[model samples]
Target: MKQTGAIVSVADVAWIIALWVNRSIHSSMKTLKWLLNLDFEQQMNETEKIKRAKQIAIIAGVFTAFVGVLLLLNYLQIKKSDPLNSLVLEKLVERLSSEPNNQQFVEEIRQVDLLMRKAYFTSLWQVRTGAYLMLLGAIVLVLSLRVYYGLRFAIDQPSADQIKEKKKRQLTQRWIGISGALVIILAIMSAFFTMNHLRSYEPEKMIVHSKAGDESIEQLEIVSIRTSETEIDTVIITESTDVEVKQPEVAITQQPEMVVFNEETVKINHNAFRGSWGNAVSSSTNLPTSWDGATGKNILWKTELPIHGYNSPVIWNEKLFLSSANTSKRVVYCYDRNSGKLLWEREVNNIQGSPATQPKTTEDTGLAAPTLTVDGEKVFAIFGNGDIIAFDLNGNRVWAINLGVPDNHYGHSSSLLTWEKKLFIQYDTHSGSKVMALSTETGKTIWETVRTNDVSWASPILAKVDGKFQLIMLANPNLSGYDINTGKQLWSVDCMSGEVGPSPVYGGGLVYATNEYARMVAVNPKTGEKVWEDNYYLPEVSSPAYHNRYIYIATTFAVVACFEAATGKFLWEFDAKNSFYSSPMIAEGKVWVFDTGGKAYIFESGSEPKLISSPELGEKVFATPVFADGRVYIRGVKHLYCIGVN
Candidate 1:
């Protein structure tokens, strides 16, 4: 099939050759008939034959010249502007990449691309058909010219002047033959050049290489280190430079022993941004009620992070994972869960097309606002610059790829989510919002679905509601649910607005979503119907948590509010002088909410607000706390502090 397509790539040339071959055979048959004395130049009407031959030659020559000129114009048109490789398309794609959120440009590119593609195939068709007509005209012109000249050159009586005329005719014939050979040679060369040029433009391959520039990954360098007698698993990092690389990639490194390692039982061990299923609730018990960072009360350990980030920490059984970044480097840090000692920190280098300079971002949503996800055997980290890297338990770099620099006002803060072997990425831009599922082991795209939602800062949630798993997402204008296995959107409630920073929560047989300036609504996950909605005490940055029959929200306006999950009734709100950014988490029937001033407000889970204790963790807090093995892991503004029964 490919070979056949290649032949058609130079369709005009192929058509000309085939038609000429047929004409040549016909001319040979006519010559054979004349040689057998079937027709002796029609000597009965000599003058008439000469006149008719002259007229035929003149008409054929004019027609052949016209088609020849037309074909030259067509060739120049193709050579000057290949529709697939048009400058217009290139510029449009470039603008679309930089301004991905611009719907106008996105639509324009898609429309123009469709037109150019139609023009491409149309030009190919015209080339084949027009070239065939031009060749036929040329052949007729040649045959008529032969008939006219042969009649004129005929000499019945042998004469010196006649002999001179014959010699002159022979010289003309020699020059014509040479010219014809040269024309054929040039046509053959042009055909092969064109065939080679159009090889990459396969007709079936549509949508010009992802909207983001081609990911060109030249090579990977894997490096490993060992502090103790564990496997020196190598984490591969790539160097992104001005050098050209193509397309996104995620390569996996096999384990040394290839053991069947699955952390199915350790999911609730603080695996994702919230918990195993994106709900900020844990089943662990005996959590500390109070702690003082300044006095070291109930503080298990404190480690100063190398750099600050807004992303929360994720924990496995014995290893805690977090990521941090600056303008020059994006690094993933792993620490020992027991001692809070830094086990290893590897700079994620060599991503094919990671942005050299960071995009303009608000301080609130720093470069590392998205928290890491540890799916049993391997841990994954994604930065605001659209760089996602995965590493094994022993710090071996599994795979990494740049999702292209996102187009966002506050930067891409949507964290990563994992369910089983599939990883979900919710990339919401102004007009280019979409969801993508990728293989956790290989980083290959499993499915991608374009969305019509507004720009969103909220991450996604994979929740089990109505005895079925669904991927829930919060974006402006809608709270949507999608099938976890496939990316098909199940249901959507168009009741959200503003920046929609808070991720949706599932509780009380409903999903709750809210924004700062918008209303909070609880929707039925199965039917997409709103069960209840409240207009007051909305959250800006902090995600809400559900405990028992109440929904707790920590707002930026110095308040931790609670309401009934089943109804829109407001239970109570804890007013304070400080604002809140960290989300609230539920553990052991207690609601733990943190303020920006590093104060923790613990409340008993009930209809009414019961403030149990207000603890202080010294430094400011932005990332939500993670609970693992009864200890609360808080990613403070400058340090990772563990609160437990110390």
Candidate 2:
């Protein structure tokens, strides 16, 4: 009996020791699984893990294969160059160039060009987006695949066979990585290969006339300079204007890339805002003294504009440029100066940072109130939304930039000025005022100067005094002058008041700044001294025109006033039947003024205001009359009419 009890006690002790050893082994295995981040297997039963791993492996494999196929397709697409370039675009551009007066062909070309640009840019954006998605999908696929493979062999013992399987898995991963890297390389190369390289525009050799009555021929290149992200066809590169320039007291760093502009601005016959150089006068002495729009007498042509805008027209090298916009879209139009036929029109869009919605604007200053200005190369237009863009002479987009939504009570109606290779703008608002100069080559800012006034709807004019060019700006009560190249304020005088709308005119050794119900003052630009002051008839919108030795003023009221250029002595004053918004333009020794009722009052540019003819245009006219090539181009509510005897 004693021997049997001792044996039983020993057996019980052994059984307890065996249970403890088993529990300790399970605890150590759980700790190992947690440390290795294999906790999914620890949380799930054997059957559940097997089912989950199978689902994960199939889904990940299918997704990875699908992404790979997409990448391959995208790569093939990028390898193929733009179909638009080889298709009908080149022929269209050539045909339009030959038949420049064909309005229908011009419209067709515009439509096709818009479509081609949209398609090309969309594809580029797609390729960039797909690359990032492919990389992310590849990473997810590898991780899920590893988890699935480990779960499949969870119950197996470690041996030579398992080690061999691990090596094989690593080999498969290495091949996958290599394939991915190769695809990336091919895609990068294709992106470069598929860039847009449209046919460049080669302008005809220009004939330059010298002061000594000599003629010379010069060749210029208007080539295509491609940008990677949003590449356009070509650009007319000019780094500065042809005006006189002086360095500022403070230094400004210019971009390393600069281009030259061979401009002969002295022989100025072009028509921009205030006519040539904002002077509002032409040297031609053979203009038609008689025209009747109501009777269609001496009216050369009348073409209906697509949209109505308050902005005036600019003429350069027999091409007319202007901009018009409604709430939905903004567009620039180029017309044949002789035939009054539409040459081309391009909508301004795809500009980065452009507002999706336009700001609030009044009816007087509509969305496209600001006039377009053209250098011999590029034509620039700005809208009330502050979107400034330049188009080549052929109407292709060169560069675009947004000046942000202007804080103007009426609307942003500041006209553009192009000098040398630089573009100037007077950005005055109710909040603050600034004068900015942008590079015509890349639309980059060359210099900026801030002003201390607020809320002026007037435009800046470029003036030359003492052989140096200065930018004259009218803001609120102060008229200021700035250095064009350096954007430094030279001088300012408090000579204006009220809502200044009429742009300043510089002539007769003085700068003319005017406002309604305020004094129309002329000041010496060099000394900032008031040369003369006339309060008899101040114009609200009509900027004074200087011709010969007389100053012409057309007020919003039914008044026409003439003043002596040397003195502010009132030469003569007369009140017509209609109000005038269109400024008086001096051409061929005649004063041409269009009223709001669309009646043009032609008078003599002498000390005595002798009325030549008050012809009715039969429509409302607000834009200033543009004199080009011995013709008067006027913009009515819905028509652009050429009034001259051919």
TM-score: which candidate is best?
1
Model 1 lDDT tens row, 1-646: 2322333356556446545654554554354334334465664365666676666656555554544454455556567667667677689767766765554665566567677766666655555555566566566667766776776666366489978987887899789757754654454344344445567643334323443353421123333323232223232222222222223233435455443324455455888888767888887777888889989999999999988789999987788999998778889999998899898788888776677788888888878999888777789888888888888777877788777788899988898888768888999986478887777877766566667778899989877776778999999898988777656677878898888899988876889899999999999988888888898899899898987788999888999898988887998888965898888998888888788998888888887778899989999988888887668889998899888997
Which residue pairs collide in model 2, if any? 239-421, 240-420, 240-421, 241-419, 241-420, 241-421, 242-420
- The TM-score values for the models, in the order shown, are 0.64, 0.60
The global C-alpha lDDT for each of the candidates, from Candidate 1 onward, is 0.75, 0.72
Write one digit per residue (lDDT tens) for candidate 2, span 1-646: 2332343344345434433433443443343334336456557665565565455445544444444444455445434545345356678756755664454665566567566666555555545554554455455545555555666676677699878988898799799768866765665455444443232222443222323421111123343323232222222323311111212223335443332333344234454686767778765555676777778988899999888689998887678888999888999999998888898888888665578999889998899988888877788999999899888777667788787789988889888888888888889888777788888766866776667787787888888889888999997889988778667667778878888888988887888888898888888988888888879888988888887778889887789999888888888998987888888887877888888998888997798978988888889999998876568788999999887885
lDDT of 1: 0.75
Shift in Å, residue 435, candidate 1 = 0.7
Candidate 1 accuracy as TM-score: 0.64
